[model samples]
Target: MNYLISALIITLIIPIWGLLIYFLNKLLYILLSKISSEKVAMTVVNYLTIPGVIHHELSHAALALLTGAIVTEFKPFWPDKTSGSLGHVNFSTRGSLFTRCLQCTFTSTAPVILGTLSSILLFAYAANNTVPFYILVPMIYLIFSIIIHASMSFADVKIMLKGIWALFIAAYIICLYFQIDFLNVIRLHLIAQL
Candidate 1:
């Protein structure tokens, strides 16, 4: 069925998008390092993706707080070579098992959710062609910066995997509440694209 195919395509898009971002990040770092010292390359890349890093860390902290976790430490843009992280958030894991799982899963995945929403809004605005050239230029850069860092870090993904069941349940509940036929929606969107 077309709906089945569309669902399959939708499922494939997430991993493909993540891989594309990962490769692009690695390629940028490699190219920059070839032209300068490794440290300099790292710094340049960090600065370039600063907006996304800030957004990513803030999303984690915000969602952690919202989910009844106490944020202990928050670093928006501290590039740690040892940890290989651009930023991080530490939160207290004091809650029931289900609550803790939900907190971890939601907090870890917040960046991708918020970043994707932001990118969609930005793209819609750009598509309208109403903004001035000066504003549009920075908007494009911001969109690129946000997207490049939207993918989860390894640690985030690990945390998410530990509580992925919570995410699935939450997603299902949301779809139910919204009266969404997930496969049908995907099928319609795919047809619209074509």
Candidate 2:
């Protein structure tokens, strides 16, 4: 009986996550997107991509908190309302190095991998679950995120990959120090460039 409840919850949890991802992706696609040259698209995609990164980062923080990792806060990325190309967000952590690493991986990879995984899980549930919404929601999120994160001819994949790695490393360090801030760092660097 315990096994049955555990299995049921496990099945429900992932599909629910998938559902959230699906709606989130759609929301991002609608708002923070436009037609641009490959160069411009690439530039924008890095920092001001969409609302999806919020989903990714929040997922990481939530998972960490669940596993007893100390998480101070997290923020989502949105258009500067001034311009695109600014990925400003607020987050902090206070956890052991190991827990922080786990948190980092979760936060960094959630949009790309778990976001993808969430979609896959939904599709799987759609194959067997009675609630078609279970599958539909996440499928949408997966598609939108994949598109937003994708390198438009405007941006090169090599550059994007480097940014991803940098974000991953930053997540770890952020988790280690509760006050370390990447959002302010990013904003300052952008200001300098301008």
Candidate 3:
């Protein structure tokens, strides 16, 4: 029972955080637009989020390769006229439905996972070591940038949510049968080790 609750919380937290960041980013974009031309605002926004954009797209590509999907198109920052994707990865979907769906879900959610890990590690390192002010400020900015940008677009979520139920069921079975609190294990090992 406790493991079930933990699993649910772990599964839900990242998506909620992503949605919050998505809305916040949209609001910031609108606010920026009011101060400048839409084009300028977009450019500025993209520039500010370059690090996140790169991380987001690279994560997709990396996962695609890992899942044996052929990555055909990968744009870290493409100014496409029609698609509103600031960055994207177009990969072949030739796999078992379960594998494809799970990979897609992981690919879409990779930014949050990677960004949070990166931020925590950086913070831990900074705390453990005596860092200079100049280095510390940029590190802080980078961490915040990653956090603010670690959200998937609606389209990305839609693709993942198509098989979300299946993923949930699989998670439940794994946790219930194994009596494993996966989240607690991750929190203890990954976070504590840092």
lDDT for each candidate structure: 0.76, 0.46, 0.75
Q: After superposing candidate 3, which stretches have Cα over 4 Å from the reference?
A: 1-5, 34-40, 177-194
Write down the TM-score of every candidate.
0.77, 0.38, 0.78
- Model 3 is weakest, by summed lDDT over 10 consecutive residues, at 162-171
Model 2 per-residue lDDT tens digits across residues 1-194: 33333334432343344445455544545454555454554444444435445555555555556545565645555446465422332334346665545444344334445556554665676667675567676656554554354221112122223234334445444544554444555678999999
Model 3: per-residue Cα lDDT over 1-194, one tens digit each:
66777667656776777788788878878988898878877876677768777877777788778867788999887756687667788877668888777677766676767777877898999999999999999888777677667787787688668656556666777778888776667788998889
Top candidate when judged by lDDT against the true structure: 1
Q: State, as a TM-score between 0 and 1, how close model 3 is to the true structure.
A: 0.78
- Candidate 1 vs candidate 2, lDDT winner: 1
What lDDT tens digits, residue by residue, belong to model 1 across residues 2-92? 4344434543454346546667877888998998878888776678769988987888898899999899999998888797888889987
Error of 2 at 178 (Å): 34
TM-score comparison, 1 vs 2, better candidate: 1
Question: Which pairs clash in model 3?
Answer: none
TM-score for candidate 2: 0.38
